[model samples]
Each structure stands twice: as structure tokens, then as C-alpha cells.
Target: MRALFWLLSIFALAAGLAIVARYNDAYALFVWPPWRLHISLNLLAILSVGLFALLYMATRLVARALALPGAVAAFRAQQRKQRSIQALRDAQRFLVEGRYGRAHAQADAAYRANESPGLAALIAARASHAMREHVRCEEWLRRAAEHDREVRVARLMTEAEFAVADRRFDVAAERLDALRQGGHRHIAALRLSVQTAAARGMWGDVLRLARQLASHRAFTAEQAAPLVRRAHLESLRELEGNPEGMVRYWRQIPKPERNDRGLVRDAALLLNASGQGELAAEAIGDALDDNWDSALAELYGRIEGGTLIERIGQAERWLRAQPRDERLLLTLGRLCLQQQLWGKAQSYLEASLSVAPSRAAHLELARLAEQLDRNELALKHFRSAAELTG
Candidate 1:
């Protein structure tokens, strides 16, 4: 259609020029002194203008004719590219929907058709992973890595996760080490490293990775504390066969972290074992100041003092600060009973039961009432304790 339009346009232009040449008359009105000329002015001017226009149109036609094949080639290439992109998108959708087989097929087709081999390999790897075809996943991931080092790091990280899922701790650790060595220590890599270290019971490695992660702000301080505490405890536990080694290990932990409940508890138990009651009591006191705990309460009650009064006084001080603390109240009541402060002990125990009734509280109160020669009240508290337990 365009060809016909150009042809018609050229013919009309030529005919119009011919008509102007045939009708218009040119009379030479003047000449320069050294020159002599005679011409039909309209015909010559029209023919010159028409020839220039024709030449321009002809040149344009030649250029377009020459470019037509390249244009067609480019258009076809674009369409093919579009198809490859569409195939990749479909594969991604299929993978997201968990249709692994279809996703693999689509990704394979896209891989063959697309120029972005790295992206195609990624899709293929994901599809293979979803299908549990680990061998195929590794092959595709390797292809991706070869295409780009950034892609390689990403592929290795994914592989590490898969290894961990398969309980391949050693392989996961190796992969994490490679990632860290390659300077690809992103949050995901650090997190996986932490998990792998923990799974392998590599406390040293766990502590190192956790500290790295915390330093990078990958986890909040609160989030990382428990893992750090656990790692420290595990390290200490390993030295249990050697008393000097265990004590040295305990001493090495920072004072602030040693104040944590888990570490404090472990230290108290260890101290009690080593017959260091005074140090254990001090540690327990520090731990309770941070948080009230039933275990700590019981541990405090078992410590030796001059008389039960001294212990009871210590507990009453704790209760004064935490008035509604049932655990402290119960502990204070038990200590008072031992000191023969029956009225104070009974009132405190009753207050504890009123706030939060428990088998332990009832039993303690029953024992306190018996000590006071209140047999009826003692029996009643004992029955309540039994019912609560049952």
C-alpha cells in the first residue's frame, strides 16, 4: 500500500510540473553586460524544482528498500525475545504454584530461547529444587554461577539452605565458609551459618557467627542474647570434666552476660556443687534483682545462714520491693516458719494463695499451720493442696 502511494505521489508531481511548463511563458527581460541568455522562465524553474524533489524521494526509497530486510530481522528478533520473556514469567508462576514439572518444562524452553542464560538457569534451579531433584538443581546452579559470579554467590547460598534442610551440616558449613570468604556475608548467609553451627554443636563457630550477625545489625541485641548465652553455656558444659577448666571458663564470660538467668542458674548450681554457698547466694541475689524466678527463690531458701531469721529477713526485703510477688511471698513464708514466726508466715502464705493459688503455696501454708499447733487449719490447707495437685 505504501509503495502504491509513493508511485501515485510521484506521478501527480510530474504531471503538475509538466502542466506548469506547458502553460506558463517566460520572456527574458534583462541580461548582464557580459552574458547573453534567452529562456522560458516558468518551464525551466518548474523542471528544476520537480527534478530535485524527485531525486530526494528516489534517494529515500532506495534507503528504505535497503533497510527493509534489517528492519524485518529486528522485528522478528523482538518477537522472539518477547516470547522468551513470557515463557520465563509462566515458569515463575508455575513454580510459585508448586507445579514443578510444568515449571521445569517452561524454564527449559526459556533457557533454550532466551539470551539471559543466568535468569533461565535460576528458574531451572528453583524448579529442580522444588521437585527434589538435587542433582539437576546443582547442575543448573553451576551453570548460573559460571554465567555470573554474583549469581554464583546467590546459588551457593540457596544450595546451603538445601543442604541444611537435608541435614547435610558439613556441606552447609562449607558453603557458608565459601560465601564468607567471597565477601558475600549478607544476612541470609550469616543466619544460615548460625543455624549450621548450632546444628553441628560447634559452639565456637556459633559464637563467632552470632557476633558477626549482631555486629552487622542482622539481629537485635535482645534477639542475639539467648543464642550467645546458649553458646557460652555449651562451651562451659564441655569443660565439666575439669573443675579448674570449668571455673576458668565461667570466669571468662563477661560479667554482664554472666548476669543472665541461664548463666546465673548454671553458675549457682555449679557453686553449690563446689560448696561455695556464699558466692552462690550473691549470684542468686543478683539474678533475682533483674527478674523474679521460682528456681532462684527455692535456691535462696536452701542456703545456710546463722538462723532462719536472717534468711527470712533477706526474703522479706525482697518481698517489700515486689509486694505482689507470689514466689517471694511463698519463700518468705517458708523461711518464717523455720524461724517460728507463725503469724507473719501464715499471713504471707495466705496472701500468696489469695493472689495465685498453687500446690506449693498450700503445702507450705499447711506445714506452717502445723508448726503453730493449728491442727484444724493445717488439715484444711493439706486437703486444698491435695485437691489442687489432683
Candidate 2:
């Protein structure tokens, strides 16, 4: 299409020139000292136009020649920019592919080229650490730190992670504390904080951080359960000697978690071990009220505190709801035994045996039989208990 258009244009121009030349009755004369020259006006016009065209072409060529060096410089700069970008990209890929040595080299190249220097240095640091080049890793991390405005937060987080991996909890804590000073309790940071706290035996912090992470949806309930449970266990242990602290911490825990069988058992046992058996009984009773756990029911029979009659009454109430529950029947029988209602203890124990036999119920019956001086019956119960244990 363009060729056809140019062809028509050229033909139009030639035809117009032909018409002008055919109608040319005009002339121009020029006189010199010894020569006179005559020229057609149309001819003169053609020559003048031809000369202008030559000059335009010459000007364009000179301009291009003058710009040559700068153009070459620009082209080279663009090539370097592309190379730097490619190096940065390759470094990241190598890091992901586990090519630590190559990653470090490429990252270093990127840093020298000044392409996102902070990110480049951090990549180098990570690669160095992966290669077990501790000295080089630290050096790269320091270099990354120099670009503080660009990656201070990233550098700190990376260092904290490395510290945690090395079991340097104290150092990890220091780094995490620095992050906190900057108001960064971001999800990832909170996760690191959880590890640091747990490793340092800072159970309270572990609980707090785990809860925060869960709330942020960084962990699913199923995933968070074990962590939260562990933190509670450790926290209870930490307060083993401090009855008040243990109670306070227990109350501070979310009410829903108080019903967790494992956590409730641990808390109760710890309270009992610390000479706070009354609190232990209260915790167990409260947990049983919220939700029936056979293990907790069995534990309830052993904790030596609270009003024996009240516990027996509580067990009776649970019996109405779970009549076939052997653990509850056993608990009721033990409570009755403690209250010295020998006949009632005997009846409840027999009922528990009918529901399901347990070593605990047999042992309780053995003790009751001994109290009553029934030698043969006591011997029978003792043998049963041993058999169940075996």
C-alpha cells in the first residue's frame, strides 16, 4: 500500500513538472565580464530544489555523526542495566534451587552493580549461611546492615532466625526485642518470638505470642492447639511453687481452654504437687462441670481436698447424665469412702464394677474392706487390683 502511494506521488510530481516546462515561455539571463548565460525559469527552479535536497541530506548525516559517541554510551548503559537485573534474578533462583555457592556469587555481583543493594546483600548473607561459611555470612549480614534504611527490619529478622536455628535463644531474644522496639510484632516476627520465648523457658511470652499468631490466622486452630497447650503446661510448671501465681495464670487462660483434658490434668497435678490440693480439687470439679472427661473423673477421686460430701453430690449429678460412666461411679464411691459412708461406698463400688472394672475402683474397695476388717474380701480386692495392673 505504501509503495503504491509513493509511486503515484512521484508520477504526479513528474507530470506537473512536464506541464510547467511545456508552458515555459519564461527565461532568465545573467551577464558576467566576458560571458552571458541564459537559463529557463523552470530549469532554475529544478536546480534550486535539487540543491536544497542535497543540503538537507548532508545536515542529517552530520547530526547523526555528532551523536555517535553518546548513543554508544547509552546503549552500553542499557546493556549493563539488563545484566544487573538478570544477575539479581539468577541469584534469587539459585537461592531457591539450593545452589548456595552460585547464589552467593551472583548476589555479590548484583551488589557490586548496585541493583537493589540491600536485597542483594541479604541474599548473599542467606546463601553464605546455607554454605556454612559463618564468617562470610556475618560479613554479608553486616554489609546488609549498612543499608539500614533499605533493609534494617529484614536484616534483623534474618539474624533472629539464624540465632534461633543455632539454639542461641538469648541472642534471638535480643534481636526480637529490637524488633519489638520498632513496633514490629508482625506475624512472622511473632512466630520467631514464640520460638525464642519457648526456648528461653519464658512460658508466659510463649503463650502470648502463640495466641497472637493464632488470632492473626497465621495458624489454624488445629495447628495452634498443641503450641497453646505446651505453653500452658510450661507456664504451670514455672509457677509450681507459687500457688497464687499458678491460680492467677490459670484464670488468665481463656475459659474454653480450661476444659482441655490434658491441660486441666497438668494444671491440677501441678497445683496438687505444690500443696494447693484445694485449688486442684476446685479446678478438677470445674472442668468436670464444663465437660466430662474420664481421666479427670479418675483424678477427681484421688485429689485430697474440698468437701467430700459435695464431691459425692457432684458425682451423683453427673451419674444422672452419664449413668454408665465407670469413672464417675468410681469417683463417687471413693468420695463416699472418704466420708466414711461404708455401705454407700460398697454400693457405688459394686455399681462401678458392674459398669466397667478399673484398678482404681478395686484399690478403693480394698482399702474399704481393710477398714472393715474383712480379711478375705480385702485380699480378693487386692488381688483384683494387681491383676488389673498386670
Candidate 3:
């Protein structure tokens, strides 16, 4: 369709030119001292149009010639820019590949080539850190901050990570605090805070940061559970010998955290050790009622100062649900002995041994025998527990 339109337009243009030529019969004459020249009006018009077209073409050529040097320089600069970008990419790839030396070299070259110097310096810093070049790592990190003010947070994060790696908890804590105060507490910053807190044995801080990370979905439930549990355990251990402090700490822990069986058991054990057996018993009972844990039930037996008869009643209630749990049986044996129910204590101890012959059950049986004045039977039980230990 376009070709047909162009064909018709060409014919119409030719017919219009023919009509103008046929009607334009006027002429023009010019005279000089020795020569005279005459030309038709149509011929004059054609020459003038052709002359303008030639001049336009010539001017365009000259302009292009004049601009040639700048165009060449621009092309070279573009090539250099591409090379610098490629160098940065290579640096990142090498860093991921664990080729630290190569990564550092590429990053430095990219920095020299003026391609995101701040980012390049950060990559170099990471490479230096991987190579165990601590001094160089710090220098690169400083250079990164100097190159771009916006990258200072990134610089601080890198420094904090390095400090954590070096076990320099104090330095890491300072950097992390600075990040927080600057309103730059991103996921990575929070994760580094967790590491730094753990390194410093600051269990409270570790727990706080870990909970923050978990809330952000930075860690899966599986990963977060153990870390939170460990932090809680360590915090409970730190509160040892201070029953008041342990009680305060326990109350401060979130209810969801207290729901974890392992964490609850650790806290209960710590509480019992500090002569807060009532607190331990209460915690253990709450946890077991929510979700039964055999290990925690066993820990229930070791608590010293709680009402033994009440604990025994609680264990029996749990027994209705878990009749075959040997740990619960062992706990019942111990709780019965505490209440001086000699017959029931012997029955639970023997029942626990029949289900699972643990050395602990043997020891409990020996103690029960001693309480019953069966010296020979106590000696035999002691010998059997010794063999199991060996």
C-alpha cells in the first residue's frame, strides 16, 4: 500500500512540474562590461534549488569532521566505563568463589577505574577479611566510608562483622550501637548484633536481637529455636546463686519463649540450683501441663523445696496420660521418697527400672534400699549402677 502511494505521488509531482514549466515563460537577463548572459525563469529556479542542496550537504560534512576528536574520546571513555563495570562484576564473582586474592585485586582495579569506588572498596574489604588480613581489611573499610558518605552504614556493618569474627565484642558492640542510633538497624545489622552479644556472653542482648531477627523472618523457626533456647539457657546460668535475679529474669522472658520445653527446663534447673525450688516446680509444672517433656519431668524430681505431696499428685496426673514414660516413673519414685511413702517409692523405682534400666534409676533404687535398711540390697544396686557407668 505504501509503495502504491509513493508511485502516485511521484506521478503527481512530475505532472505539477510539467504544468509549471509550460506556464512559466518569463525570462531574466544579466549584462557585464564584456559579456551578457540570459537564462529562463524555470532554469534559474532549478539552479538555485540545486545550489542550496549542495551547500546543506557540505555544511553537514564539515560539522561532522570538526566533531570527530570528541566522538573518539567519548567512545574511549565509554569503553573504560564498561571495563570498570566488568571489573566490579568479576570482583563480586571471585569473592563468592572464595578466591580472596583475585577478588581484592579486581576490586582495587575497579576502584582505580572510578566505577563505584565505595562499593569496590567494600568488596576489597571483604576479600581482605577472608584472607585474614585484618589491617588491610580495616583500611579498605575506612576508604569505603571516605569514598561515599551514604556508604558509612555499610562500612560500620562491615566493621562490626569483622569485630565479631575477631572476638572483639566491645568494638562490635560499639559499632552496632552506632548503627542503631543512626536508624540503620537493618536485618544484617541485627544479625551482627546477635553474634556480638553472644561473643560477649551478653545473653540478654543475644536473646533480644535473636527475637528481632526471628520476627523479621530472617531465620526459620528451626534455626531460631535453638539460638533463642541457648541464649535463654545462658542467661539463666548467669543468674545462678541469685534467686531474686533469676525470678526477675524469668518474668521478663516472653511467654512464647517460656513455652519452649528445653528453655523452660534449663530455667527450672537453674532456679532449683539457687534454692528457688518452688519457682522451679511451678515453671516445670506449667511447661509440662502445656506440653509434656520427659526430661523436664525428670528435672521435676530433683527440685528440693516445693511441697513434695503436691508434686507427687501432679506427677500422677501426668502418669494417667503417659503411663509408659520411664522418666516420669523415676520422678515419681524420687517424689514418693521425698514424701516418705516407702512402699510407693520402691514400686515406682522398680517399675522405672523394668521399662528403662538407666543408671539414675539404679542409683535411686540404691538410695531407696538404704532408706529401707536393706544394706545388702543397697550394695547390690550400687554395684549394678557402677557397672552401667563403666
- Residue 84's lDDT within candidate 1 is 88
- lDDT tens string, model 2, 88-193? 9999999999999999999999999999999999999999988889899999999999999999999999999999988998999999999999998888888999
Residue pairs with clashing backbones, model 3: none
- C-alpha local distance difference test of each model: 0.81, 0.89, 0.89
lDDT of 2 at 114: 97
How do the residues 121-181 of candidate 1 rate in per-residue lDDT, one tens digit apiece? Answer: 8888888987889899989888888777446776777779888988999999998888888
Clashes of each: 0, 0, 0
- lDDT, residue 153, candidate 2: 97
- Cα lDDT tens digits, model 3, 116-152, are 9999999999999999998998889878988757577
Point to the candidate with the largest TM-score.
Answer: 3
Q: Roughly what TM-score does model 2 have, to 2 decimal places? A: 0.86
User: Candidate 1: which stretches are off by over 4 Å?
Assistant: 1-42, 89-106, 262-279, 293-295, 302-313, 332-357, 361-385
